[model samples]
Target chain A: MSSRRAPRVHGLMTRGYADDLRLFGSGKAKLGLLALVLAYLMLPFFLTSDFWLSVLDYAGIAAIGALGLNLLTGYTGQVSLGHAFFIGLGAYAAAQLGGPDALNLPLPLWLLGAAVFGALVGALIGPFALRLRGNYLAIVTLGLIFLGEHLFRNLKDVTGGNSGTNVDTTATLGGLDFKDLALLGENFSFNQGYFWLIWGLVGLVALLVKNLVRTRPGRALQAVRDRDVAAEVVGVQLGRYKVGAFAVSSGLAALAGALLGSYQQFVSPDEFSLFLSIQYIAIIIVGGVGTVFGSIVGALVLGGLPGLIDKYSASIPGVSTGSGDSGFISVFSLNQAIFGLLIVLFLVFEPRGLAAVWLRVKAYFKAWPFSY
Target chain B: MSEFLQLCFNGTALGARYALVALGFVIIYRATGVINFAQGGLLALGAYLAYALNDTAALPFALAVIGAVIASGLIGAATERVVLRRMVGQPVFAVVMVTIGMLFILEQTITSIWGFEALNLGDPWGVQIVRAGDVVLAQRDLWTVGIAGAVLAAFFAFFRFSKLGVAMRATAFDQEAALAQGISARRVFAVSWGISGALACLAGVTLAAGPAALSPGIGAVALIAFPAMIVGGLDSPVGAVLGGLIIGITQALTTGYQEDLFGWAGANFAAVMPYVVMVLILLVRPYGLFGTREVRRI
Candidate 1:
């Protein structure tokens, strides 16, 4: 018995740098990826209801934005409340560039245009991070949201002023419009088409971010986040990494906004406010900070919560659906209150957020038969 | 020129209100190192509580104001004890976000309790005006300036002479050193929150006293005051007052002259002028006019 060799765990062992950088680190992870792909391909057909389909579409959009935010705030330790501004910028960019009277570009060009514009603006703002730290940086970004709103409101030619502008941007690429698709001789609805388009992008963006985070710049960002002075002492260029992170994060956010505008077909100045910024912050905080998968999880949960609440508001005891309803709290107020409570409770009780909970459960199963 | 003087008078009155809010921010920030975003909620709560006491409870206006101020102070202290105490050692981002969460909860709570309709504050100085050398000022505005000046004087005196205040300042300067010297850091934190709450109450009362009327949106004034706090330097009380005055004057002047000077900029540009000014100022002095620059070490 003593001479018998221990049973080897094949997929669990990481014996080299190549193994360490593998996207699917273990058998379980590979299986999870396969399951996710299956769900992506098949879930639209299974969930044919318009309500659930739209909800998932919105969640996919939020996931894209949240991934961008997680890159900057979570991995780079930069606190920003101006995400709504960038989102709005992207939406308006789509409106102008993809609209009939303007540049009249197609889906990919407009989305890329919005990202470039967002990156330029982000680069302009990134220098402020060099000069300020902590709370000051946060408040300055808050100011950016207000300024963006003001610009959106007054720029009548571009944003159509207070009444808002219609985003007639098409999601067509290479003779295949996402608004209508025929697969296997079965026609699909707009929501289903968007479900495929948005989630497909979500997968692509996630892969891109995951790859980015595993590389050298990602390590430099984490080093700066842990301690900027120490990072600089260790030969990391603080300005380049800080500014680059902002550019990349804002670019992703703008891409998400372009998708949202195209999907919703409407963009309004009021849509981008302090509350919207707070919502993005809430998503990252609730999802696990510094985890790419956590952003998607958070977006799926918190992003879909408001729509779920709205759909079922009549049944909730104290939620007033209309002005004359017999309840103390309006549906909007209830939603706001829930968001506030979630932020507070999660921060106090589970600082590491839902990702940590998932990690714990996975660890528990991995060490089965005997408690570690 | 007379029109400009009138605008300046109104601006100073507005600045006084901003100064009061900024002062409250400075006190809490100096003591606990947390920028209390929930201060706006406290401000709105104080005004609404005074409204309830005066209109619902049928108390005298002055007495209701006093009662509201005290109650708000206690609420502030209770918040520090209950929620913030647990968050003492967390990162600054987490603490600030917690306060923001509290702000949302408080705002919604006020709306649920008070409803959305605007209510008269029922103060004695309701839309009354006074004239001085061809410049007219609202009675509430005059009272705001006078009261704000008195509060500033009292706070400075307290900081200079009071033993507890000295302990608070010492704690702010260096927490570990103050603790070693037997200063109760927790008490200092609580007291600072309490004082900030009272100041917020006063600012709310003055802001809601005149034609503004008490409403849920009244709390948003604290957002503009954030600019004031930043401009004066986050830690300087005097800087807050100066920053408030500067922002108020700039906003008032912009409103007065936007039609002529900035017509091309767009209508109602004055509303966002403070933010523009803040961005410009921050570009010049990241630490603000009076804040000390932090030293970094590897």
Candidate 2:
């Protein structure tokens, strides 16, 4: 029996609880990680510039939306080309619920309404089209983006048509004005208030998603993704798991949309176009699929890269940041071209994404000083 | 009675164009098992090629058509040899994504050359519409349907009778067997691409003649060809033609009737109607109207 226990695995394995903590399963490591997170959370307060704050706000919104898509595509092996449809649906629901006259409902209720609407709409779209497998599902979802756009453009009364709705900013909760773009206006400004609100929501959502991934439902989703037939054989219901994943993803996407609408104080069809959906998918792929941290990292890279390019290119010699007809227009359009190239290059060379690279670097450092 | 005949005429004409485009998709898919999302981009290339030859190069219409067809054929073959050949054994998903990326590259190239503007290409045969009581029809539309049907028939004859066509078919059916029998599968792939490109050129010419204008958006209509291919049955060429015809006619009728009823004031429904039908049809018959079902052993 002692011979059989002789180091079958090479990792720092131990039987005792304290030994386990010193090796792979360490509470100290987790506490250290939590401390690092706290520092990160505090770092933003030191720099509250309007421009940077606004950028962070948009990045938060994008991360929320991309996280939802990661849940669907990353965990469930489903492809969705119409994710923006759900986002737009949520935005519209938020707008409608808040009402033109501020119908006396709480802000949280309105947000919850948006999420419920998203889940319902997602469930409706899911089972109807997800019955088929492979590229068929992709096409169906892609068509929905078009359909959703057309509906938003044509339904003048409900969706406010192509121009979209200007959501009223009168909703409130517990004597705190919800529509006050600057919650911290006493010290900072409007942009920072929006930034903090978005960041707070992102943190809460991330924690919820982390916990969800460890639960039975999340494991079931992974099983379905890896092998549907095997998962089914093991008593995991395919339709239910897939539909549940869609609902949760859609709900989160809707939350992002609602927040986006609140921040912009407006909602429009163009915000949820096919290009936006493609942008969300590209961010996840570039960030690394199925990773929580990947969503945040991907959002920052996708959102910030173009701005940085334009900012630097304006001063560079021979670089056309402004050429009357040939100069970089807004960094946004240039980013589209770059985005396409990035996806191709990343898929070809770095399929494991930035998170994987980060992991490898950390492991390298940890394994250093031994010189083995 | 004249209205019904006119509807049939219009349906056949529109369907013929879609068939030509869908047929192009089917050829590439049959040979390589890749869903070439770049079909629309290639269609635009064909159209632009013809336009450049006629307007810029100062060639006769007939000569320009031939030049465009040959140029597109070479382009097709080059693409397969260069980009697609590198992705030979990759998963189907990756290959599909590569084609999607190729779409962006093709679009950028065309835009860089042509500028993003709609250009008119004059009719091939100096044609005019023949109007009857309560109905009118263009000679070009008739020519389009006739030419499309003739091309389909010619391709069928080629595959069934010609030695080269048989060789291509053999390669398509089983590359290993074709190689064992001394037929070069790569050469067959090039041939299929060439034929597919020629078909795209024909469709492009017909489309340019219709509105007498071309735009980047024109290539987008090629997306309709995918649904048409699936609706017709991916494995069957004849089904592609029939499927395209059905989709085109249904869309035309829907737009025509909607205009009569609601005065929507646009042809947008005509554009989206085929996709709607495609989704509905896919719901009932995922393999498509004439598509084959594959058996997988786990």
Candidate 3:
């Protein structure tokens, strides 16, 4: 039996050709990976309860947001600390349009309004912001977060001020009401009601991102990220791509925010703080940059960690969960500490992230006989 | 007319604080070719240390300030030796990101140590008001302006005439050449961080005595220094001061005159004004008012 396995293992290392097992360098491997991902996503519906399904829903929303950031920061090499501002803009636009006393626009138009408005605001700000580089860029964008919050707070008619705006579940896609669990099954709640919608959006965004990377515009973005001066010399319009990336990133972030707002039946300024923006960046950093699969993996790891902590908080002696505050807060602050440490650690030691580590492990198993 | 002069006076006072902070920024940028995002956090730490030392240890205010500055200088030196020194010769983006991560670490540390309360920091000099016709000026504000002026004069002399300062400037110009000439780039790096650290402490002290109480959020004022650097020129020391003055007065005038005209919220606009100016300057003159343009070879 051992001798029978040797040639198979040797074939993995020799591959008969260099490109056969080169990891993401072949279409066969890519298709195999896609099938595996489909199984992983669908497995939850069969194996998990509603609570776990809800966790996956939140992960889907985060993965969408992280995918946007990865496009801008990973593919284009631009840093932004104002991501949550765009998300807030999208969420509030939808809420205001569909609120009880809002202009009471149709649901489809309202969602479109959120994305278009976010892109416009992004373009307007990008001209000014795209000039800054390095930490200066980060600082300027961070300032925008504060400015956005202040603007929202001061504009009472639009944002409802600090008290925040709430929706009564009236906004939905056609007759598919978000709160109507009956549409799904007798056993399903609204959280489970959102399971399919969030994943469908994730799948759509992932496909869109994957296709974008293969287009000419995507090639130009990658070129600029690799070397701006060289890209400019090759007839790539640096300014256009810089602004375009921000617009796309902001529009996607808004899309996620809209989904979140509709799912929760509420949208508030506090929900879209700088912390959320940072968390999104952290998600992408842990995820493989510029890869769709990385976004999903990163979102699951970072998003699920806190939920795990909340569930197990009571089991850990001397770890006060701070019950008066949301069980989420006490655990999440610890998560922030861990996340910050992870970024530093990843940058210094394993900058390629968990995806890179997983690839290494897979390679070792495939090439077991030779171990070369 | 008097109210106008007083607005200018208050503007200059705020400008002086901005200049001190921007000077720290310029020093590090010129020497290390990296913007120290942690400067604001360092300033806040310095201010908090002074407050803590005076309140907790029951030390005299003057002695506490001295101790605080010393602590800040040590922090700066340690950061250079450990964090920044390791990052030497790395790509600009990587180094910049490290500094940002440093900012996150420092912000959390400050929050952990001080909690979130804003504290009223009293002036070293007793509070007194002087009237100039229709306007009023605080004695502490005058002190801030005077001290800032003195610090500027001293910095000029140190950089122009002193030996170590000349060596620092030489290292800033060409680090490898300076190293070839037997001037220790490491020492130059240390001295730059030390001086910058001291300036941050000075700015923190004076700012603590301003209109608002000292809080961790005061680091937001770093935005003012950022635009001032761009306006003054990144490489020019004198430009930093001039830029600070211009930015300060422009913000004051806008708040004073443009508020009613534009139906804008004055204070919020004041916060954003520097960034708006920074964007304009960056577009029109990338080298800024006093900065030297560089050739990119790719």
Candidate 4:
């Protein structure tokens, strides 16, 4: 029957508008997504190592932020070196709104509060993009980092000053405490609960971003990114899209920061420096620019690096584990060096990033019989 | 008034160093159309090299400085050949990130070799002072000003008269046009990087020449120079120098008047004063005081 071969993976058949916009158009993709959801739910149970779980948790948090950066830098053609500033803002917002001393709101409220706070600030800063472009815009944003750092350091009450403050916020959702979960009469550790919570949020954010980029506004953003003047000429309201992208991007960053603060239980000004911004940039670069899936892929690849480096530092040669050891480089320096090297190597060799590689593999499979 | 003059003297010394670094930034930006964030790394490397030659190897201070400058120049040129050439046609953001990547690598390399501990630079101008008309100037500061003036003047002269200078300007103006006229873009790029590295090294040497100034943290001055570069104009050498002096003097005045003038702003307001000034100036003059405004053709 023709039904057996009704639809093909790469068939050039007439497709409806709904088919074009479908996230998982192919049966294979839908099945793959189902498999992913199953694995996401089940991974924490099988992989119970505290170290690895924490790594995944952090990676999930970073993925949320990286997705936002991709939307800004990839989709909207804006390069912001002040991501760390916005992240710090979110962290502080969590500390203020969710901490026991402050409003002490629930998990959802704090997270949304932080995101909204970051978005408002990001909107305020977006108008500068209208006046400046390219290198000049980049430098102005760089100033934001310094100014933000100054504020973080001096504003002792809200940010807890340079010494940092505790982020002891409760993470509960409708009588289900993530910090201590009870599922089907089985008690789960904090790590297990966190893995589920963090990854679950990652999935939600990823879906949100994916849907956003598939719509008319998404096309507007891409146009602005490709050529702002042309996009404007073509009736794309440059200001609204640019500012909206920034707000959304920064909101995601703040959400990540809120999670990071809640999970770590502590955050200082030092945690949100220029290096943190660079790290996010590296994540997007190594993952794949302008791709939602690439952001998560990049975060997953780089998220566990520091943990892995620290774990194996004792065995690595020329790595001083402790201060004053007879080694050329300390473990910290080595980790940073590797990060820098990864950025350089990835940019030079695999500019399209790991996502592109995966896409190529998929393409090759799609053209299996007539591979040229 | 004397206190003000003293602060001015110190500011001038600091400004000279910023001028050198900013000049290097201008050279690299002009030639390659990419801001070389790795200048700080090169600055640290050159300063360390000077320290090694002067103290560890027991060479004359002047000779060691010269050797380090030459080495840094060659290293800069080699880096352009080996690493940056591959990134020639990449997006501006990508190229900028690449240099930032280089910055981290270079900084870590310096720390791995030298460790994080502060080291003495062993310059002859140690604690030596010259008093002149209500202002007490360090011998090193005086020498720094003198050297910077001479080197900057020499560079200006070269840029004004030399064929290579003309070639660099031509390439900076229109890369494809210069290529069509038979100018080797590669050579121009490499030489620009070399000159930038040389300028960075000189800045480093001057910075490290004073007592207890040769620390790993010395490289951070380049970050402040960013503001100086922007305030002066990205493409103008004279703008860079002026911006440096403006930032340097503002910082010095803030530091000097911290207790009286900036008490409410909190401690160490001077450290961030340059950025504040840069942002304020940029809001009014987008292209900076001396920067050429871009004329975009759609």
Clashes of 3: 0
Candidate 1 lDDT, A189-263, residue by residue in tens:
999999999999999999988998889999999998999999999999999999998998998999889888988
Residue-level lDDT of model 4, residues A1-372, one tens digit each, is: 454755454533436876677676576778889999999988866887889999899899999999999999988878788888988889999999899989999989999999999999999988887777878888888888888888889889788788999999999998889999898897888988999999999999999999999889989999998888899999999889999998999899999999999999999999888888988988998999999999999999997778888998889888988875788998878877887888899899998899999999998888787775
Q: Residues B178-226, candidate 4, lDDT per residue (tens digit)?
A: 9999999999999999999999999998998877478877788888898
Error of 3 at B65 (Å): 1.0
Q: In terms of DockQ, which candidate is stronger, 1 or 2?
A: 1
- lDDT assessment of candidate 1: 0.91
Error of 4 at A51 (Å): 0.8
Off by over 4 Å in 2: A1-36, A102-104, A169-186, A304-333, A369-372, B86-93, B122-127, B132-134, B162-195, B260-267
Chain B TM-score of every predicted model: 0.98, 0.93, 0.95, 0.98
For this target, which candidate reaches the highest TM-score against the unseen true structure?
A: 1
Q: C-alpha displacement of B100 in model 1, angstroms? A: 0.8
Candidate 3 CAPRI assessment class: acceptable
* Alpha-carbon deviation at A359 in model 2, angstroms: 3.3
Supply candidate 4's per-residue lDDT for B174. 96
- TM-score of each prediction: 0.98, 0.86, 0.86, 0.97
Error of 1 at A345 (Å): 1.0
Q: Assess candidate 2 and give its TM-score to the true structure.
A: 0.86
Give the per-residue lDDT digits (tens) of candidate 2, residues A1-372: 555666565344567655642322455566776885685566456766766766777888889888898888877877777789999988888777876664534678888888888988888877954466555676677778777777777777778887899775444556555334333444545665566567777777877776677667878888877767788889988899888888989999998888888777798888787667767877887888788878878987785565566667666443344435454233444455566666666666665578788878767777897644
Cα lDDT tens digits, model 2, B1-298, are 7766677778878889999988988888788877777777788899999989989888987789889989998888888887777778754445665666666657666765676678877555445887877677787787888889899999999989999889978877888998899998888888887888888888888887756577766777777776777788776798899899998888677766767765553336666677788888988988788877654323
> Which residues of candidate 4, in runs, are more than 4 Å off?
A1-18
DockQ of 4: 0.74
